[model samples]
Target chain A: MFLNLFLLLAAVLCAFQAIRARQMLAAALWLACTSAIVAWLLYALGAQEVAVIELSVGAGLVTILFVFGITIAGEEIQEVGSLVPWAVAGGIALALIGLVAWFVLPAQEASTAVSEPSFSVMVWENRGLDMLVQIGLIFAGVLGILGILAEKETAEEQARASQKTPTSTPPLPQPQVITTDAHQDTPIKEAHA
Target chain B: MSSELTITAVTVLCLLGVALYGLLIVRNLFQVIIALQILVKGALIALVLAGKISGQINLGQSLAVTVIVADTIVAVVGLALAVQVKRYTGSLDVKNLSTLRR
Candidate 1:
């Protein structure tokens, strides 16, 4: 119990930094730390399968992707103080969540000690379909992103090729769009067209 | 010492609230994604905990795996789009982007 509390406290500290950090990279780092802690939390809770997934994808892959995003969308680090209102509000919300969680999660789960099944059984028998879908979804994402990037590359090539001088220096990391999420759920659309 | 389930669930809720707060007020697009990641993690925690509570551990594992997969896909695509936006405007402020069309 003390261990869990420690880990959760560490996560809370990370979350606070994630929200309060001045640099985007710092925030991303804090988030990564939080993800890693959560993975450990899962393992302690006897969900080794989910823990591994969370560790690899959430802590590993997602952090890399976040760094990639931050790098691609480079921005000057601005001073982050004067956001006290945000901090206060976050604190209250966190407290409220703590209370809700205490009430919502049953005490029985603490004592419900079931022996764990083999990992292979879980994967082969019950979750084979989910695994297959996961594989397919990953491939689709790769193909879609490749297509989008290739399209962008060719466009750049044409633009650069048309100009008398090869000046492709305008690819600074300005996050100039609000529609990142809608198409994220459907990278396959790019693959189709 | 609180039960493992209570500690885990409390952590999950803490994460959710922190991420929600970030989503509501933080504007750095990458940070927003981080917030979203936390939210997904919360779902994952709940899945694992629910399974433990009900003795359906495999089912919970399956669902958590699915969520992880979907979350990864979303992260990849989201970053790619963010890259596209960066290439287009040469800025990552999210405030600069207002329209879908050029």
Candidate 2:
């Protein structure tokens, strides 16, 4: 019980740090830590299958994606604005929690002995459609990422082409010839007058 | 009240609250995605907890797995969008995304 409490507290702390970290990379790392802890919490809660998935996808894959985003987007430390928004958001969150508590506490006695089928049977037989849809969603996500990246490459190529184009240069000023003869100078001066 | 359930409930609530607050105030696109992940994690835990309470552990686990898969796709797509937004706007600020409407 104490260990569970410790893990939960650690998860919360990591999550807080992830939100408050000024550096995007640090935030991503903190998020990974939170995910890892959350996976452990899930394991403790008897959701071993979900725990493994969360560990790999949540902590592993998500962190890699975040780092990739940071590399491309270039991390900038965003300044925190006024506390008004934070306060307002906090109030709303508190109200939400209160509402949930009101609804959930009354149903605390609803817990029963778990007697479900094996995890594999549940996922393969019962949730087969969901699994198929998940596969489709992953495929769509991959296609979308490819399209976005391809567009980025095209934009970069266009920018490069524009840079490579030769700019028009202004014609050089004509050289002025000074005649040693006074006769030549007198005619030019007369023409100007 | 079962102490285990109470603890899990409180933890889930705190996670949701923190994520909601971050989502509300964070201006960075990356942070928005991070906040969303946090929110989903809270929900994931809640789902498992519900499953435990209702004595359908397998169903809860299956739903959580589905959520993980979907959340991963969301993270990937969101990051991809963030990259494109950065490419177009030259910054990761959410405020700059407003110019897209124009």
In terms of TM-score, the best-performing candidate is 2
Candidate 2 error regions (>4 Å): A80-84, A109-114, A164-193
lDDT for each residue of candidate 2 in A85-120, tens digit (9 for 90 to 100): 888978887888788777865555454576678999
First chain of candidate 2, TM-score: 0.79
Residue pairs with clashing backbones, model 2: none
Full-model lDDT for every candidate? 0.76, 0.85
A90-113: candidate 1 lDDT, tens digit per residue: 677777777776677654643555
TM-score, chain A, per candidate?
0.64, 0.79
- Name the lDDT value of residue A60 in candidate 2: 96
lDDT tens per residue, model 2, B1-102: 477777887788889888988887788888889999999999999899888778787899999988998999999999999888887778878888887675
> Which candidate gets the maximum DockQ versus the true structure?
2
Please give each candidate's TM-score.
Answer: 0.77, 0.87
* DockQ (model 1, Cα): 0.43
Clashing pairs in 1: A173-B91, A173-B92, A174-B90, A174-B91, A174-B92, A175-B91, A175-B92, A175-B93, A176-B97
